[model samples]
Target: MEKERRWTEKYRHLLQAFYFAFTNGYARGYTNGMIFTGKSKYLCVPGLNCYSCPGAIGACPIGSLQAILGSNTYRISLYVSGMLALFGVFFGRLVCGFLCPFGLVQDLLYKIPFPIKKKNLPAHNQLKYLRYVILAVFVILLTSLIHDVTGTGIPWFCEWICPSGTLLAGVPLMILNPEFREAIGFQFFWKMGILLVIMLGSVAYYRPFCKYLCPLGAIYGVFNPVSTYRLVIDKEKCVNCGSCQKACLMDIRTNQTPNSPDCIRCLKCVSACPTGAIDSSWNIARSKFESRLLSEEENSPNPEVTKTTLLAILTIIAGLATMVSTFKYNLDGVLVYHFSGLTSGRGVLAYMLVTLFKGIVSFFMIITGYKLFINRNDENAVHRFREQTRMILKFVIIIVIAGIASLFADLSLLSVMFNAILICPFPIIGLPLLASAASSTDKLVQGKGSAVLWWIVFVLLAVVTSYIAYISTVIILAG
Candidate 1:
């Protein structure tokens, strides 16, 4: 029995290693620090393996899902979604236990000698719900709802959250690609902070991410109750000993619930059952007596943070992106690259504000271009192109009108409402002026003190820039 346990453990690890190697088999790409943009890239791997990983031959399902959700067309990733549903219906968290490379990483991390290991985290039950929140917010809501100028949503999970990509894909690419390394900034460090916390947490707690923060795991776990393969307990042979619970690393009370959603099908509970009551099964034909013995009441399970922290983190990320845009825009240089600082003291403060707004636009443009490019051949590229074109036209019309008005003011409109003052404040001032014109009050803008303050500042700066331009033009004419 002990040998069986050992052999099973070894087999799971071996399978994990082989699967990881197979998913990331383009060793030469790793050597050259390149991504494999081959036919196999169309396939989605059933793990959290990164598509951007140098050696990865297949795409990560979650990333693929995000790309589709965040695209201009906002189409569902049928391929990725189908793959996930298929995997979930069949395997559930078995992938977490035996297939996910990140899962294996956490398993290996736990094996390293540690002074004090915890059986369960504090508030483990409630905390487990966090993965669901992440799935809903980062993976779905942010990716689908919040869009940029290009009508492309950002993959908020990959951009600001995923530690797996940071550790597995980001680090290796950073080591290989000079340009990628150069682009690394606060975003990279923010990801590293998340990664460090997961690594340290895993050392003390088993599979902390799989238990709590993994959006993929949360998705798979939902199918566990209905999955084709499942863990079973024979009630006739069962003596209600706590041995199974003792051996189960997931803190699952298997005696009451043999097929708990959290169960990774590690088989520890099966191996530890003194009466040999626990077993893995596919609901094959069995005698009525045996079926009754396996059956128990279905009633079971357990269930159930930082709004300010999230706000601060998001603000920091936004500020960093804005900062990067103001001076040297690395985002495909939609326009001028270098510029004076926000406090350059030339009454050109609107330029700073414009750059901030530009950065915001550039983020969407950059992400949209990336998503469209990456998933172009992978999907209906034609639909995406059309969607983007329509969105661009709608925005361009506004910018054109703003441009004409700004030309009169000798101002560079960057704000959207400029769809008044002009090239620079076109979008920012767009809604307010339009709304004010219609209703005599921009309720949304007027309701917020901060919004009102920023609007005042923008107008004052624009007037100053117009005066500067007029003076310069007059001097040039006189000369």
Candidate 2:
């Protein structure tokens, strides 16, 4: 029982590592050495999994980000960046300590009886700054700049550095894939050498790459002091025996500064402090009194008011998400990317205008959606509805124009059919707008006939557009 209770979050670190590895285990991809390009590719994992690892089910955020930042299509760039920030806010460098597969590999390597001269590296302080430089120049600046003839820049870190790519993706793929082996060059060997050196160094030192090379670590480290979940020192309980610092692999003075950026949040310091002065917790910087006050304030809201507030919040959030995905994924960006063959400067300008119009419509949506759901504006409801309908339709005309523009991108029957779908990013937005324009959105949602009418209108528009586009393309080709 004592052994089981020795560590407060026992086996959690190992469990997280195992969990991520299992999730990334696409066993068939190893046999084929092909990336799993499913819908999960859009869901970037928090840890630094390789972009092209055969077994990876999700895309690496950093690698995918380089492509997105370099290309004209940044449909999911903001979304991925937001995910990275969300992770940093909650866990900071705890990702490095446990979640990253590469980090786990390095940790296992360290146990091979190759201890360094000291726990930390020589000139560790100065060497640590190298990661920030790599993060800025190699990861961000080069990926955004330094383009080739294809109008996309080199992902410099992935091309020249990044041992994770080398070890996880490069080595396995070369062994498994004949076609991939044909493309091998000096660059592959160079990356392999770096990976070997880092592996050996992990045995000699503690995570040399994380300390001096990993841009992701640099990015997450910046959030350590500010992240919602982090370490704290209870000064009242502190005997200042310096046990925490002695146990720190990163050599952080945990008693003096518990939330240091260099700290990987391993929780070893918490275990080392015999006084139990060290702690791993949420909102760690806040006082007990402050937390209690926040708790009280949160509970003070009546249940009905809390429920309504939650509903309003959720409605606005849904409306905003709908607006972004509608513009970014369905209607505008797809046509802009696939149909760029025919779409020139004027088309690009039109797209920009359409995107701008989306923001206004989104604002109107959240306002009207919030008001409609709460049964507000019962006074002169008809006039308000008429005004919202006019405003919304006017903006939607630009969207219709965007869909129509897709037909010009290509004259193929497939293109025509896709244009119909783009034009109708509808049915998704349709029912909501239909309800929002009514005196009572709630009642409209309840009305089965109203929903049926909306679907009919949607179908009619798609069929009519498809016929017109196909006929026009046929006539033009004949001419």
Query: In lDDT terms, which candidate is top?
Result: 2
- Report RMSD (Å) for each prediction in the order shown: 24.2, 13.1
TM-scores, in order shown?
0.58, 0.59
lDDT of 1 at 111: 86
State the TM-score for model 1. 0.58
* Candidate 2 structure quality by residue, lDDT tens digits, 1-479: 22332453467557667856775788888888787777888787878899688888887878877877777555236876788898898889988887888887887787688534346777888988999999889988888877888878788999899999998899889999999899988998899899999998888887788888998898889898888777878899999898988988788899998888788877777778888777766534445667775686577744333323433443355446446544544455636544765555554454555555556666776786576446432434434544665676666676566656744653443443344335434423553444343434333333676566545545644543564465457547857
In model 1, where do residues sit more than 4 Å from their true spots? Answer: 1-6, 282-479
As a whole number from 0 to 100, the lDDT of residue 391 in candidate 2 is 70
Overall lDDT per candidate, in order of appearance = 0.68, 0.69
Residue 393 of model 1, lDDT score? 39
Candidate 2 ranges with C-alpha deviation above 4 Å: 1-13, 73-77, 115-117, 283-479
